[model samples]
Target: MAMDADLVTAGVLVIGDEILSGRTKDKNVGFIADYLTQLGIDLKEVRIVADDTDAIVEAVNAMRACWTYLFTTGGIGPTHDDITADSVATAFGVRIDHDPRAVDILTRHYQAGELNEARMRMARVPFGADLIENKVSSAPGFRLENVHVMAGVPSVMQAMMDAIAPTLRTNSALLSETIDTGVGEGLVAEPLRIAQERHPEVVMGSYPYLRDGLFATKLVLRSREQDKLKAACEDIETMLADLKGQRQAQI
Candidate 1:
């Protein structure tokens, strides 16, 4: 299907063997999703890959081509396993070397003897890439085309996101309304399906949960168009009201 030109979309790539091995719990994906959503950018997909160069390279190329923007986290550190910058360089077929700007930042942040070879690895970036500032740490992230590579630390990644947010292209913010149906999903499924069919533009979903030891559902409707979302929500309310009446009659 052809995507709406007005809709801006993004993809997230999380890199690290620690994450894959369950050694590190990821916190950046949800943060980035919320951040992008507020800016009217839809986060369409997320991929978690190990710290392997081939895997990172493949994910970078695939996601960057598929979405308007691709945000990556992890593997851009001083350690030997920190290979995100190099992998991204390979993906773009660009030369990887110490970016003078990044090196300068690290030099300023660290002491005379602290900026060793291991630490210098953080300065390496793909050719022709713009630096993404890291307020938490001196080691900066880089923006190579549409792909943004940032540190794995939550605080640092967030800072990079803030640095890059202003420059991003955004679309209309998605509007959403949630209705507590006060009933089970099974009872509301057919009605929700009908409402979805009637208002094809609105995205409708029913989330089932336990309330007071009984089944309950929350129906959420979302759309970029306010009028359509409001209309669809009203129709859903009416359907739920009718369903309630029918249940009472049966009782």
Candidate 2:
């Protein structure tokens, strides 16, 4: 955690009907979250919409308006069903056309006359967007305002992130500490709540786990303020120890 870091936040839009129907498992959301977090940008929301135009447009506009940045994956490829480019254009109220730079990149990647009309569809971009290089496939993604459009494929999306990472804005990355207690959440809830009350600025949560028929509670504390986060973690540690000791005494 850094003292002067601003809370830059982002949202992710996963567009595809295949994903909703369970035909295509999503592989981009987690990567986007981890990537953004590494850049100190908090991922506040993630929306998965169908390939339908209205759905994509509405979700994109809504998330883009609210977050510092919005990332979209899927539906940007070259096919009849790939309506993401058009939907994004409609959302921004801008024209969509074959971007020459994108076309040139594709041209070089494909042999003469091999780059057909369908493949050229990858070159289409919304007006006013800057191309995001795709080192893996040459068909670049684009960045329009706060919205970044990337491919659905995991490797390609990862490459696009690398290409665009330098341009993204960031803030203080969250810091987290976890303490495990060999007891159930019910045994620690009250004391944990009291500790959280003492540190309002930190986020505190308890997760219960069952292993080998034994229950345990994992307390995770997160905060951008390192000092406060450290103090809260310390308090939780003491609370857990005292609680465990008391339980042992009663046995």
The numbered model that scores best in lDDT is 1
Q: In order, how many clashes per candidate? A: 0, 0
- Candidate 2, after superposition: displacement of residue 248 in Å? 2.4
The top-ranked prediction according to TM-score is: 1
lDDT of 1 by residue, 1-251 (tens): 24787678999999999998998999999999999989999899999999899999999999999999999999999999999999999999999999999899999999889999999999999999999998998799999999999999999999899999999999887899999999998999999989988899898888999988999999988898999999999999999999999999999
> Scored by Cα lDDT, where does model 1 land?
0.93
- In model 1, what is the error at residue 14, expressed in angstroms? 0.5
> Cα deviation of 169 in candidate 1 (Å)?
0.7
Q: Cα lDDT of all candidates, in order?
A: 0.93, 0.90
Badly placed stretches (over 4 Å) of model 2 are 1-5
